[model samples]
Target: MHLTLGLHRAVRHEPSSVATFYEGRTHTFRQLADRVARLAGALRTIGVKTGDRVAILALNSDRYIEYYLAVWWAGAVVNPINTRWATPEILYSLDDSQSEVMFVDSAHKSKIDELREGSTTLEHIIYLDEEEKPNGTLSYEDLIEDGEPIEDSYRHGDDIAGIFYTGGTTGFPKGVMLSHTNIGVPAMTFLCEEYGFGSVSLHTAPLFHVAPLMYVIAQLFNGGRHIVLSGFEPAQVARAIEERKVTDVLLVPSMLHVLLDSPVVQKTNFSGLRRIWYGGSPIAETTQRRALEVFQPSGLVQLYGLTEIPVVALLSAAWHAPEMRKLRSTGRAAQENEIMIADANGREVPRGSIGEIVARGPNVMKGYWNKPVETETAIRNGWLWTGDAGYMDDDGFVFIADRFKDMIVTGGENVYAAEVENAIAKHPAVAACSVIGIPSHEWGESVHAVVVLKPGAREFTVEEIRHHCKDLIGGYKSPRSIEFKPSLPLSAFGKVVKDELRAPFWRDAIRKV
Candidate 1:
């Protein structure tokens, strides 16, 4: 089915139902469909033909959703930009994707001219805000107001739907090309699950990210209410949930903690909330327990996947109980996905053996845009090789150990950073921590930790941390050295940027990530 099929279905089934709630403004399905069709005409008027690349560089908003549907409505491909990226990184992606038309908000408008100058293919910029149109750019409202409605182009199945760029933690980001089938299969399967129909789903996570973007499609299919926040703020999210009676929301572990700690949550009634979907990183047991306390009635679901394959496995709410042994696992593979642990040679390994997580299904992405070599390297024999090192238990629950690159080899014994981080995080004084391999003349490489202490907590010595970890893990797995910081460096999606943490220590090392 086409990506736009959900929009058409929603319009047909509930034209007058509220489609989106954003910043005190509301739009019905009818209104959304009308604007999308007209915007599609506007895109065509500006020379956007079928298969043309159109990009949007803005935070979550009603207009962002419209941009996605309208682009697909015009039979064009959507390239959603990461709002947190640097100008140079943004320019690189624009040039690489050959995106000629871009939609820019006031927050990023100042860099428009420089981006245009730097990119070889970018030509037009649409001012995406309600404020006065910037000089030399087309106004978003004017385009929809004046342009005539157009027919749906019906791009479907293997047709390329969207190109989402990954965070360049290692180096430059690659554009992950996802087809309509890649999204639709999983979305259709979601309907069979507990994602409530006609539910009020809040979109606070950046819509550019694949996880939230997939929720958008899923909500469309369910003809549910979309509550769009400008971005994630603890108070705003708490208020939206209480005021709008939001039924479900998606958050990363970091966002979840902030939301739980927010003072607004104390006043908010969470009885209306049915689900709390979180992914992007594993949640600490402490955080999970706290979350269960705050949203007692809501189901906490864990999603696991990369941008290339959006839903490889889903840990349902039932597995999140404090006493459940599967709480740490990502849960079994989803209904339509086939997941396995594979070695470097692409051979499936025995259960409980750590290897690269490989997944295969209709939901797998088409390939990386314009990178055949990398595409071949990622997907072999119909399985997408997710660089995560993980294992499956006898019950088929998949447990992610760490990223293969993040695994530290000290004294010829392998150490997974995640295992060490979990132990460090358990220390009462530790707020957050990351483990990496640092060069050591004696052992060739030593496990090192960067930690952030809890606010107002007393400082502790490195020996205290190592002694604490030694009780839980092997001496080799304990951090050899410790550095205290106010905060850890994180990518836009909330994963710790290990490359930046390793750069200083590996500057002159023979091996580098």
Candidate 2:
């Protein structure tokens, strides 16, 4: 089936049902389908065709939603731009994808002239904002009015559907080539599992990221409505959920904290909320505890995956056991794939042994776009090496230790960030924490942690934090030093930007990330 079949199926099932609550507009599936068709026709009129790449640089607006469906319906691969990125990064992805056309929202519309000046691959531009291009460049709505719905170019079963670029702040980004089957398989995996398969999903997470996009496609395939938030605001999210009776919402750890602490948490009715799914970063027990208390009716589900795999493990709704609360472990693998830990030799490690996590499944991406060598290094012998330090317990639950990049090797001893983060999280004063390896002359690399203290809590010194965690975990695992910050810099996915945090430490030094 074509990826666009989801939209068609939803319209057929409940044409009049609300399909999207975006910005100030509400749309039913029928209306959405009509707009998608019109927009697709418009895209085609502007020379979009099968296998073509179209970039969208916009916030999570109603227009962005329309662009998603219309791009696919036009038989083009959707390349959603990371709006948070600077001009150079945005230009990199657009140039890499060779996207012929771009759709810029009102906010970023002003930057087009500057970006377009040096760009060679961008042949056309369309503005989704109210102020159209002073030149004859097309407006988003006008393109829809100028064209007709072409036949459903159902590029299913291995045909490329989307080119999702990884957030490569450290270096150049690689485009993940996802086939129709890759995403179709995962969408069906959730549906077959009946984990709120077809329910309203709030898009507080950036739509450009894989986590939210996976849900957007999955929920759509399962005949669910999507409530698109232009951008995440705790109060606004709570209000939308309360007003729409939203069934499910996805968050990463930091956003989870924001919601629990928001005044809206007390005022908004969470009665309609069924489940709260979180991932992209480790969930602190404190954050989870607060979340459980605030979003009472909503059960928390954690999913773990990399950009290459899209999604791999699902810590199912079953693991939310009252007894399992303190374990801090991701549940057993989802039904879609097999999860195993591999050591340095590429051999599977025994249960309870820590190693790199690997998986082999249909849901995994085809490969990195235009990077054969990197793709080969990541996916060997049909298994994708997730670059995550982890272990499987006797119950088959997978415990993630840390990313291969974030693991600190001090005097040949491997230290995990998750371990230090967990230990710091136990401190009564720490609201959130992150551990990163900084340049150290004596040990090669030393652990340095940055912490966010709870409001009104007295400041603790670096020595105090190190002394506290020295006994809980290994002495070597304790951070060599701690730096208290007002807050941690989190990505759109809510994962701490450790590389960014540590950049100043290695600016002129010979150290590797």
Candidate 3:
């Protein structure tokens, strides 16, 4: 089925129902559909043909949702730019995708000239702001006002729907090409399982990310209301939840951490919230415990997946209970997805044996855009080999150990950074920490840790940390070196950037992982 089918259904059955809520403004499904059709007509007028790429660089808003449906309605591909990326990274994606028309919001308008100057193919720039149009850009309102409403293009099944760019922590970002079925199927499955009709969902996470996009799609499938925020701020999220009576919301672990610590969140009434969906990175046990205490009424659900294969597995709300034993696991694979632990030769590993986590399902992307060799390497024998190191138990619970590339080898023994980081995070003094392998003459590679202490916590020494970890993990897994930092570098999705931590230590090494 077409991804835009949900929009059509919503407009047909609930045309007068509220579709979106943004900063005190509301739009009904009828209004949203009318604007979407007009925007599609406007895009077509500007030479956006079937399969052509249209990119949006904007924050979360009603207009952003309109941009998505309008692009699909225009028979074009949606390429949402990562809002946190640098100019060079953004330029690379636009140039690589050969996107012709770009949409810029007020927040990013200052960089428009530079982006346009650096682009070789970008032709038109549409301004999506409340103010008057910029000198060289077309007004978003003008397009909707002047253009005529058009019918849906009906792009379905294998038609390329989106080109989501992964955060390039190790190197340049590659665009993951997803088809309409690739995204729509999983969305429908998720909606059937979790969300009910007319649920009120909040869009606090960046819409550029696939996780939020999937949630948005699920809401659309259920004919639910969307409550959008420009960006994730703890105060604003809490306010939106209480004021909008938001039933469900998605957040990364980092955002959850900030929310749990915010005084505004503590003061806000969380009784209206029914679920808190979090993922993108592992949640520390301490942070999870605090979250459970802060949002007592809301059930927490953890999701695990990548841009290539969205929504592979989900740790259900039952597992988030304080007494649950499977809290450390990312959770079993979703019903629609098939996951397995594979050895280097693409052989399935024994139960409880750690190996590369591979997944196969309709949700898997077609391939990486313009990167044939990388696509071949990623998807072999119809399975998307996620570079995550993990294992499944006899009962089918999946525990993610670490990224295969992030594994630390010391004296021929494998040490997963996540294991050591988990141990360090248990300490009351520790707020955040990241483990990496550094060049070691004695052991080829040694475990090193960078730690961020909780505010007003006493200073901790390397020996103290090693002693603390010795009781929890193997002696070899203990961090040999420790450095205190206020914070660790994070990717757009909140995963620790291990490459940055290893850069100085491996600067003179013969090889870098």
TM-score of every prediction relative to native: 0.81, 0.79, 0.81
Candidate 2 Cα outliers beyond 4 Å, as residue runs: 131-136, 167-170, 325-327, 406-513
Model 2: per-residue lDDT, tens digit, 1-513?
A: 467888888888989988888777888899888888888887887788889999988888777778877888878898987665556657878888899898887778777887688677987888886664646467877766666766666678788888887633224667898887777776665565455645888898877776777777778787888888888788889888988778888876667766777777778789889888887655555676677777776777877777677568777665765676523676667677888899987999999888999998887789988888878988898899987788898888888765575566553344557767877899999899888887664355678888888999988887788778765555666777878889889899998887788888877752242
Global local distance difference test of model 1: 0.84
lDDT of 1 at 253: 75
Candidate 2 lDDT score relative to the true structure: 0.76
Q: Compared with the true structure, what per-residue lDDT tens digits does model 3 show for residues 1-513?
A: 688888888989999999999988899999999999999999999999999999999999999999999999999999999775667668888999999999999999998999999999899999998698778899999999998889999999999999998633234667999999888887865674567666899998889888888888889988999999998798889888888889999887767777887889758999978888877655566777788888887788888877889888888887888677778788888878999999999999999898989999998999999989889988999999988888899978888765665566554344667767877899999999998988664355678999998999987888899888765565767889989998999999998888798889878753342
**Clashing residue pairs for model 3:** none
* Root-mean-square deviation per candidate: 10.9, 11.2, 11.0
Clashing pairs in 1: none
lDDT by residue (269-386, candidate 1, tens digit) is 8899999988765456567788998899798988887788988998889888877888778888988899989988988899989898999999898998888888998889999998
Q: Rate the local accuracy (lDDT) of all candidates.
A: 0.84, 0.76, 0.84
Range of the 10 consecutive residues with the lowest summed lDDT in candidate 1:
405-414
